[model samples]
Structure formats: C-alpha cells, structure tokens
Target: MTDASVLEPNAGVTLVPTPNEDDLPRRFSDFATFNEALDYAAQGKRGMNFHDPRGTLKRVYPYSELRDDALDMARRLVAHGIQKGDRVALIAETGPEFAALFCGCVYAGAWPVPLPLPTSFGGKEAYIDQLAVQLASSDPKVLFYPAEIAEMTKAAADRQGCEGITWEDFATGAAPDCALPEAQPDDICYLQYSSGSTRFPHGVAVTHASLLNNLAGHSEGMKIQQSDRCISWLPWYHDMGLVGCFLSLIANQISVDYLKTEDFARRPLAWLDLISRNPGTSCSYSPTFGYDICARRISSQSNVAERFDLSRWRIAGNGADMIRPDVMQGFVNAFAPAGFKASAFLPSYGLAEATLAVTIMPPGEGIRVELVEEERLSGTPRDLSRPARYRAIVNCGKAVKDMAIEIRGESGHVLPDHHIGKVWCKGPSVMVGYFRDPEATEACMQDGWLDTGDMGYLVDGYLFIVGRAKDMIIINGKNHWPQDIEWAVEQLPGFNHGDIAAFSVETETGEESVAVLVHCRVSDPVERQKLHDTIRDKVRSILGHSAIVELVPPRTLPRTSSGKLSRAKAKKQYLSGEIEPIKLAA
Candidate 1:
C-alpha cells in the first residue's frame, strides 16, 4: 500500500529504535478488516523494535517492510495452492517472519493458527506432543515453524499427516504476483488455542471484525496517548501478547519494543532496562508473576533508581492470569525508589475467547482490592471455632466498550451485585464459537452469552474474579479454590509462585482430600521432610484437616503456555506417576 523504501531503516544501523510518534494520523482500528489496519499502519513512520536477550536493539521492522513481506508471502501461499479458509499453522516465534506470515495469511484469506513454541520446562517429547495435538485439532493444511525446531516440528507434522516447513525455507519459495482474495469483516482471521488447552484443544476462531473491535476497545480503555509507546516481553502465542501488545500496536499505530519471553525469563531486568531506556511514555502488560519475578530480581540488584527509571511507565497493565494484590504491592515497594507509581498499575480481565480484553481498569484508577471472607469465596459455611480469614479480591475493572458482563448462579439465573457466580459475557468481540467443536460451542454459550468458566461477582460494574470454575476443588461437598491452597503454601518462607500446585485427590478411603504438589529444592533428607511437613501443616491450617503433601523436583509442575500454573495437568501427571515424588525419610 505504501513505498517500502520510505520505511526502511538506515543500513548497518542496528541500535536505532522506532520513533515513538508517527507522522500518519491515528485511526484506532476504524477499518473493516485487519488487512486494512495493517495497510494504514504501513503508511506511518512508527513500527516494531526487536531486542536481544540483553535488551539491545537487534532488528528494526517498520510497518511498510512488514506489509511488503506479507504481500510476497500471500502471493507465495496462493501459488502453493492455499485457498480461502484454509488453516495455516505457524509456530509462533516473536520475529518479523512470524509477523509477516500471520498477516500474510490474512491477505490470502487463510486462517492463521498461532501455536506455542517449546517452553523451558516442557521437554522435547512434551513439546512435540503439545504440537501434535494442536496440529491435529487445527488441521492445518501446512505447518510452518522455525528452523531450530525443524526435526521436532517435522515429527509432529508427520504424526498429524500435515506438511511442515520451516519459515526460513518457505520464505525462499516461488512468489508470483497475483490478485489476493478479498477478506470481509466477518471472515475468520485466525485460530487461537488458549494457553491452558492440552487434552481437548479448542481453536478459538476470531473474525476480522472481532479482532479490530477488541483493538479499538484496548485503545479506548487505556486512553492511549500520542507519546505512549509499548514495551513487552510477553509470549506471542498468548492472547494478551498476541492481541494487546502486537496486534493492538499495529492497529493503533503505536510503536512497540519487544524482548522475547524466554529472554525475559533469563534476564528479567532486561525488560526494566528497556523500559528505562524508552524516551516516551511506556505502556506494558504482564501477568502477576511477571511483576513478581522482576521485583524479586531487583531486590538483590543495586541502586534501583540508577538501573531503572519507571516514571515514564504510564500504564502497567496486568492480566492473562489472576492479578495478585500482594504481588502488585511487592512490585510497587521494590520499584517506588525508581519512580514507579502505584497508580500506573492497571488491572484487567480477559480470555482468548473474548479475542483479548473484556474489561480494562480506567486509566488512573490503579489496582483496587475488596476483602471477602474465605468462606464466601468458596461458598462454604464458616466454622465458628476458627478465626475469620479473608482473601483480597482485586477489582478487574469494568466491561470494555460494547461488552456486557453478568454473574450467573448454578441455576442459570443472573445474580445480584456482590454475589459470586459464573462470569458470562456478551459482546460483538466474543467469538462465534470454537473452531470445529460444535458441542463445546453449544455447551459454553447460552443465547449468545459466552460462559467464561470463571467464578466472580460484579460490584458497581467492576468485575472481581475469584478463580477458574473448573479449577475449584470440591472435597466433602465443600469448595476450595486451588489458588487459595497454592497461595497459602507460597506464604511460607522460600516458596514462590508456580512452585506449588494444589488439587483434589481421592485417598485409599475413597474420600476426596486436598493434594498439594510442591516443587522442592531441598535435597537433605531431614530438610526435605521438614519442608513437606511445613507445607502440610500450612495447608491444614486453611482446610482444617490433614492433607497430602508431595515434594517434587524443581520445575516439576506444568505451566500453561501463558505461564499460568496448570493444576489439572499437574494432577493428571501426578495420578499417572509421571511426576515422581521425593522419598521421605523412613
């Protein structure tokens, strides 16, 4: 749509990041299709900046160059017999190639399926198994992955009976200039598999209209400013990363700097370093754990003010998992000396099924919490013998533009404010249904309202999430949220988030008991037993009964692609003996 030469960066120059302000006018995703949004973004001077593991700028990908690359890719896919509505699965690696390929499928009228890459704890076989399952579920005509994982990806592709090619090799294929298929507003733009889906995957089908609407919602919700630039280290495979950070930037004509998710894991301080280096106001989003890790890293570093300048961080958006107030507070306490403002912490709620964001905290409200009794959250009667315990439920803000939220009880009746129930949302941005899963689509939808499968209540229009509905553990007819159990263990010294997974398990007596699987780093037999006993006693204090505590190796617990702890998977693996527990002293 525009001259690529005008957007090209200076040759041999790798350190210059994209400009914070653009010459082109901001549109806020007013276009009908996502391709149109990219076309307009290509006309702007702002673009994407890629950084190395240490936060040094490596590649400068302007929108014009991305558009040209996508056009060439679209032509190549057409010449290769890819047609409208065909699924083209791409192993989502954060780079210009994947970006161009994802948009290229949009141009070609094919539904681009973004799949997760191999994570740190997930081994080769586990990664392959994950890939194969998603590949089979998406049923892509061809799967493209990075060259580094060609062997493993090929094995997965073979098992699914689909053609697999590395993106680098496929980039060299013949390209013939031809007219591309036209995409409409309602056309399926992409298929996204949520981070936690493992056994039975449902590819969340999002239309061009839905994606654009959600992007606009994010723009309005955040009150995006002309001087605002985004910095992110979130994975591209997750909704918050894929939609809010990447796609939202393009549609809104906002410049963004990115550090690979794995890189952030190795050097989290690099994320702060990039933010500190930003010349303009920065807007970034991450789950609570991301904030936790960064705060923990800076605790041992010297001179927080010298290492980071967070004053320019105008919007620190939190979502993609439960927003922990304690973690947020810890972040503020750690970075306040560095000019970090607690008011910049904007909490939100969303899921892939909603395309990206369903609710966003108002621009200056920051993180708000409401204390409710533990018995209220679990919907169980309190035992008068024990002192009352309260869990702080963080306010997840109000519904985004054109989105409606309602808390419904088990009887399918709408509940009043301050009443905990299943969270249901209705909006234009909500997906029509999961791809190729009509049964699931019907089960989760009621009269166009998508069941979010989360237990929460609305207070004066602000939604507060309790926990996942399916993640709740029922023991002896009482409900116990796994987060409450896991968080209790984390309160003990030396335990951190993701180190423990709690769930319900049946004992030899055929009665359900709480099982807490903790990641144990202690090797001494005495110390190991002591840690086990401590976690057991800690859990007992909450559950009011003895519970099962098993200490597994560090990183033994499984995490979803979005980095959330997967209690269901951990429970399944533990039951199957895949997760070996450390032997206790006789």
Candidate 2:
C-alpha cells in the first residue's frame, strides 16, 4: 500500500485496495469494546480521508497514526484531571484532530459528547444558545472546539461556567506519564443529542456495549465485503454520520472518505464526484433531502453517464428523516444512465435512542413501498363520504439481529400488523436513558421497550415509518403528516426542500387549525400574494381544508443543526412574533 503521506497532490486518496481476498479480515464484530476494535483496526492499512470542497484530497489519516495519537491524548487527558465517566464535550468537526480526540476520550474512559457546529440558517447567537443549552444539559468538565469557533465556544462555556479550550491547545499540552483509564463493555461511550427538532434536546446515553452491538449489526445486515468503501457528507454531530460513517468504518476496518457538511451543501455533486472515483464498491447514506438536492441540481444537465459512474454504488443508504419515495425515484431516474440503480437505494429506520439503527433493509431489497389508505396511517377512522387517498409508505426493512420492533397503540398495547401506531423497539442497542433527565427517559421507556416517538407500522416484520408522533397535524378529526403538506408546497415552482414548515395551531375558539410558514424570496406584492394563494390552494386541495399560509422572507424558517426543518421551533418563533410575515398592501 502507498503511504498516505506520499500521496500526490489532488490525487484523491483511496483507503481500500483493489478487491483482494488476502486483505485483513473485518474486526468490528470480533471486539467487545470500541477501543478494542480500534486496537485491532490499527494493525491494518485502511483509515479515513478528508476532501476539500472541490473534491480534492486534503488529508489522509491512517488508523495507526490515529491510535498512537489517541493513546497519547488519552494519557494527557488523564493527567489533566479528566477522570473516568466525566463528560468531555468536543465540537464534532470532520477532520483528523476531532477523530483522534474522540477516540482518545474513549481510551481515557471519559464520555465524549459531540456538539454541532453553527449551521448556515442559525446565526452566531443561535449557535451560542444551542451550545449553551447542550452544555448546561451535559454539564461537561470541559469543552473543546476548533480555534475558528473559539469565541462562540468560550461564550457558551462561560455561560455554563465550564472551561473551554481549543483542540490544538488540548492536544499539545504535556502531562506526566500516567496510566489510561480502563474501559469496560458497560461503560458510557458518549452522549448523542437527538436532532434539534425537539423543543429541548435530551442527550441520549449509549454504552460501549450498545454502540458496538449496533455497529456489528450494521456490518452483518449490510453483508460488508472486503471491497466496500464508504463516502459521506453527513455531519459528524449527527448519529447517522458519527456512528454509521465514522465509528462503524473504524470498527469494521473499512476505508472511508468525507466532505464537510457545509461544503456538500454548496456543491452537492462533489459527493458523486468522489463516489465515481472510488475503485471499489461504494456505500453512502443521506437523508431524502440530500438526494433531492443532487437530483434537482443535475436535472437539466445531459451526458450524466459520461461524467459519473454510480454502477458500483452498492448501498445508497437513506435515513435520519422520512424517506420520500418520489424523491428517491427522482434521483434514480436522473442518474440511471450514469449507472446508478434503484436497487442501490437502501432505506433504513433508526435514531440516536437506539444507538443508531433499529432496522435495515436486507441487501438488494431496495426502496420497497406499500400504498396504504391515508386513514390507516393516521390512526383515524375513515371518512366514508370522501374518496380514500393512498400514501406510499416506504418499507424500512426488518429489525437487525437481537433487536425487536413493535407497533403499539395509544394505550401501549402491541398493535397487530398493518396497524399504524407508535414505533417501539427492544434490543441491546437501546440507550440506557437520557442523561440527567429521568422524567424524560421514563416517559419514553416502558418495560424495557422504548417509545421511538415515531409513527409507523409493521408488515410481516418489516418496519414502515410514517412520521413523528409529536409533529402530526390534526385538522377536525383527520390526521395529517407535516411532510405531506411540506412536499405539496415543494412541488410549486421556485420552492425547494425545507422552504416550508407545517404544524397545527389552536384557534381562539379552541379548534385545531393547519398553519404553514413558507420561506418566500420574491419581493413584488402581486407575486408574493400569488405565491401565498397558490400554496394555500394547493394545501387545501390536498387536505380538503383551508390552511393559514403565512409567507415569510427566505431563511426565516429555522433549521436544526442537522439541517432538518424544526417545526416545533418554528411554531414557537411564529407564536412569539419572531418570524414576521411579509406585509401586503391593503
């Protein structure tokens, strides 16, 4: 294998070798703990590589160097008075430094909490508030971040009365030789804050056993092979990115490439560019919006096959939010000539609460959907007077080994197959509980099964997710999913994914009403009014009811750190008059 340090400039690094049977065997399922998995993986030549926004290789970090640096950092952390079980918050930047520090925390027996970087939608104050809230919740002993965000991190740390240091300083400090803390299977590995969609984010506590078990399941379910490589633009702060892309690859000894989340947002095609360059079978995961953005960006172009080769893209994994069949189909139709197959679309269901994955589609069983009556999905009685509308619900696949999934009604009784209800799961990968929030944890846990807070149903053991229980919008007596309404607005000309937020609001007369806040950019009064009327009429036509459509300026709608629209936050902001709509002439 060529040394990573000697790689030619702009010659994108390849971590996996040409398909060879003599390659070192996979070690993810062979280990009992994360550190053990790293120890074994370090003996191999594979590791992570990072790319610039333009898809050029910038850095190559081999597993051996990672292990060595992590061990040294672990000793330094121990010398710095960071003891076992103490929480250490680190801003999850996609690079070699953060990777080393994260694993170093594991070696030192300090639980590392990965915090998100400021997103494009949220300004500095918003980021500070987000960081402060998470810090206050975890109450970490110290917070480490990249020097670029030192000011914001310090301000958040100051508000929470915790020490804040830059990653460079933290790694450079010398300490007396000391033994690293021993990590056990049951030891807390880290705290993952469920996406920012929540009004108050709860840090999900996952143990070493839970994390490893989930990683093992990922390997077994995907039927990982020697030639498989992963390319991801998912943010490291998110569970799918952190566990599935970063940790899972490390544990399984798979070569992986990364593009910063911000960079990918600007140049979505850079993802495909990197994938086309991979010499071996490629695996990647993204939310539905990611695929939508790519397809839309390349929709008008021709000769796609000449520029890209996606035939080897084995697993185009989808998760982190609702899986849209239309969006997935759009992607496949646009790229089929480029060798991308619809079967490569691997839709799975999971959350941070379950470590990462609850269920995964069997290999090659891609994008299965069942057209069920809308009433069956809403858990509402059918309206005999109206024509039945069928919604295409994507099959998220069967539960991973050792994990059990159940759909339960409101009364907590397990519902029979084909009945839509709260999605629940029991498995070794289930989180212990929310950190420092027993009441919140108790509300979701029932007799060892976790209420996923997602509405879905089972068909012959396959999980089919519909929508979030809390985000469900009820109008009169009918159930409405926010995605259905959001998608309707997106179909309008000039609108894009995440440009609209939908939720339910209580009227003055104590009746529930559908409310929509659309991000509008047009300045003309006539055009703005036309846009509003078009959206309102479209939503009304879809649901057979009127909606209060408020047109706000572009970027007015708030987004979670992971880039998903936060309906709860949007509603709060709207109610507080923070998101003012554009005024029209009388």
Candidate 3:
C-alpha cells in the first residue's frame, strides 16, 4: 500500500559495464548476479498490468508477491520432475502469466524457452510441428502453455513424450514453496529461438548475468527514468519486445501498458490512444513498418488528433528492421497537430544474439541521414558527396557503454568508417552462444565480438545497420529468407540456373521480397506479361508469396565494389520504383 513497499530493495545497484577497478561498485561487481539486482523492487515495487481490453485492468502482485508465486511455481515444477539445468518450453502470448512463468523457471534454475504463438499458424498442425521440433531439439523437461493453447500443446507433448502443463493447472493454488537452487549469473537463464528467417530456427542461450548487465547499460545509456511508462505492441517472442519493453521496464519499476500484436495491426492508432489515455512520460519502440502503419493506417482514420496527445512522448524507438526516413518524417508531420516532435523518433540497432539492444539513438535529436554516391559507396573509402539523387539512410547511433563495435572486412581486419563490412560487437550483453550448435556459435562469435552479419559503417562513432550478410529479409518485424523465395522462383524456366535475383524491397507495408528481378534482354510488351506470370507463379509456389517483380534489361542490377550484386543496392532501386518489368517477346 505504501510507495516504499512497491520499490525494489536493489533499486540503486548499478552494474558497471567497464570497471575502473577502484571505481567499481561493490554490489554490482559481477554482471552475472544482475537479476539479483531486481531485489531493488522486492519490497512494495510497482506492479505489472496485464491489459485486458475486454475486461477491467487488474493489478497483479508487486515484485515481492510475484517473486513468491514464482518460487511456488518452481516448487510445483520440481515436484513434477523439473530439475536444475533442464530446459522448459513456454508457449504463451505476452501477459503477466508469461513473466511469472519465466521468473519461475529462473528461480528453479531451469532454462525458459519462449516460442512464437503465431496467430498466423492456423489450427494446430503447423504450430504443433514447430513446437515439436523445438522440444525435440531442446529436449525440454517440461512444456508450459496458457489454457487456450494447452490442448494443442499437450497433444504435441504426448507425441514427443515430453511433460506438459497449462498455466491454470500448474498454479493449483499451492502453498509457500520449496528450496531454490543457487543459480550462477553465468548459468543459462533462458533460450531465445533464432527468428528462423534463414534456416531452421536454433535456440540462443542467454545468461541471467548478461541480461542484467544489458538492462543496466540500456537504462543508463537511454536515460530511462523511474517515472517512465512503456506501452508496447511488439511480440514477446522477439528480443526487442521481451527484453526492451517487458524486462527493462519492470526491472526499472516502471508501469507498462501492453497491447496484443494483432490489436495494433487492426488499429494502429491504438498506440496513440494508449499514449493519450495514460498521461505520463512514456516511451515505446517498434520497427519502421509500425510507424508507416501509423502514418498510412491512422492518417486515413477519423478523430485521431482529437483522441491522442503526443506531447508527453519522449522516445519513439524505431529499429529491428530497416529505418525508413520517409515513414518517420510522415508520422511526425501528420501528428504535429497532436504535438509529435521529430526528435521523438529514436532509431536504434540490435539483434537477438546481442540480447536485444546495442545502440539507442541520442535522445532529443533529429534522425540522421547521409546521401552518398551509390557507385562509390561500395569501393571508395571516403564520405564523398554525390548528386542529390542518392537515397537517405538513417544512422542508428552509437553503442552503449562497455559494448565495443567494429566494422570488419572479409579478412577479419577492422575496416575504416565508410568501408562497409560485417558489423561486429563485443560486450557484456552478447549471448553465450547458440543453443546446442557449437559450429554456428563459433561461426558468429569470434574472439569476443559477435559478427552481426549485418552490413553498415560507423559515422562519428554512431552505428548504422545497412543489410544482412546472410541475405535475411525482415518484413514487419518478421524475418524471411531470400533463398527460400529464390528457390521458389527458381522453379521457373529462366531462373533454373540461378539466373534470377530474389530479394526484398521495402514498401509502406514493411519489406516484401520480390522473387525475381529478372534480367531478361527482351523488350517486347506481350512477352513481359508472360514473364510476370511466370515469376509470380514461381514465387507463390515455393514461398507461398508473390512480389511486384521487376523485369529489367540485363546488367541493370548493380554490382558491389567486389562484383557482387548488392541486395541492399538492388532494394534501393526497387524502392525508388524506377526499374520496371521489361516487355517480353510477343
């Protein structure tokens, strides 16, 4: 009831990303013990509100109360045969139950693995298959799901011979719990599944210590205030949503208003509505698509300006995908009447392997963009200016404290700024490795730096993510593989020998992969129609998708300084809409 009881006991414990030995805070000596820092909120800390759109807002337990419940659940799970070091699969939509379940696993010393409860997976077959695969590979000792998904999950569990329990059944209204294991900070706290946009998804092992350190760094670097509130519609399955929105907000004892992913998709303005309804200094994050959705979807709707006030919005984070300058500008311009400022748009860069955040765009600054010659960009090492014809690219800002980033060439040598190569980072937040895949873990994590596979250069100490070296396509916060679409389109006669370039082009709806930028020499109109049909059918067949294919004359696709068809460059051209489907022979 008292404010003091709501604050965590370890509230002031700040972990140092880089220790000056003498200046190191004794309580924050070890990053691995960071979750223990949540003790700051152990007393009467603020509570988590699980938004029930159809029902009234219910206040769950304070940090202390939730910790007790988590301990109790850990006991129940152990009684049901869960052991220390065991993997526990949790498939629940984002809500209080998920937070509690994850905390329970952490207390029990079991690894919590959260998988996508993708609404897109109709019925139970696809999800069951995906879950089964994950469980079989992770070899989880127990699987937990909400009541709604329990039946289907149980069926999969039965087939896989794994133990399963629904949230309701697991609760059992049990008593004050059992003994907890002494969990080391370096111990695996949870497993995050790789987005699987490129290959079969693999689990990434994140340690409790790593998570705590990252949150501390993020809080300090981004200037997260205790009074701050967060409203998010990002999915819990992803790192940005889970780590950035849920964990960081709660650890900082901040109140959060979370909306379902579908809710925002259905009504983009709900984000604005939530901001208006909750009058506080709140900050939230989303991909570029989210902003575009707000601009396109909300602009057309009525009473938007009348319903929301954007003056209190301090930081509107845009990351996890390409940062579109036009989309950010459009949102600010359209919402200016509602008091939205251009400086509120905070573009950042991060990935799952890094435990979510890497850089937070400087607060209260306009999004930065650079225009350079497309031809000289690949080879020339200078920031030479070119004609204004070049497109605007956003700067994702600098790395957080204790995190060191480098742009390295193919030889692993760090390249000078403007010399694009793989973006690599070394920091306390980097995950231990991919779960069970030593080879992949080795391939990506070299020395101390994790090769992000994204291409970008640092300008004046700020990081900018350009494209993925692995050829992964991100659309609406979802990762899709280019090879998958390429293979799909290769079924066509002209594409059989890898003659086609299938890549994604960003649009107002996020990024959609165009299956073929067919380089046919033909210029006849009737033949072009046939080419379009052939490419569309091939894409739909293999990827269950179709793109707005462009049939350009041969050699239209620009090569990199090293003679590679730069997908990033190709995407730039598609976005400009200059290249069109070439005519075919009649």
- The TM-scores of all predictions, comma-separated, are 0.97, 0.95, 0.76
lDDT, each prediction: 0.90, 0.87, 0.68
Could you give me the TM-score of model 1 versus the true structure?
0.97
Best first by TM-score, ranked: 1, 2, 3
Candidate 1 residues lying further than 4 Å off, grouped into runs, are 1-11
Which numbered prediction scores highest in TM-score against the true structure? Answer: 1
Per-residue accuracy of model 2 over 204-317 as CA lDDT, tens digit each:
999999999999999988989888889999999999999999999888888888899999999999999999999889999999999999998895657899989999999999
lDDT value, candidate 3, whole model: 0.68
lDDT of 3 by residue, 1-586 (tens): 2212212222344421111121212232224443464454444445455444532243344556666666667777777777888998888476657777788788788988887774644347756776778787778887888877777788878878988887766676443446778888788888887555212566888888788877776676667754466788877877888788866754555557767776676777777777766656768888776776677665455565686788888888887776767668878877888888888888888887988788878788769898744433334233334332244557998887678999998798988877767899999889889888898889888787898888788887988666666676554444444544554554455542224566766556665544457677555677778777877776665433456666777666644211224465566566676555565555
At residue 238, candidate 2 shows an lDDT of 92
User: What residue runs in model 2 are displaced by over 4 Å at the alpha carbon?
Assistant: 1-22, 197-199
Order the numbered candidates by lDDT, best leading.
1, 2, 3
Q: What is the per-residue lDDT of model 1 for residues 1-586, given as tens digits with 9 covering 90 to 100?
A: 3223322334685467779987788998888999999999999888988888999887888898888889888988998899999999998898888998999999999999999988743799998899899998999999999898899999999999999988887787777889999899999999999998898999999999999999999999999999999999998888999999899999999999999998999999999999999989999999999999988887555789887899999999999888889999999999999999999999999999999899999988999999999889867899899999999899999999889999999999999999999999999999989999999999999898999999999999999999999989888778888888888899999988889998998899899988899998898999998888888889999888888999999888999988898889999999999999999999
List, in order, the clash count of every candidate structure. Answer: 0, 0, 20
- Compare candidates 2 and 3 on lDDT and give the better one: 2
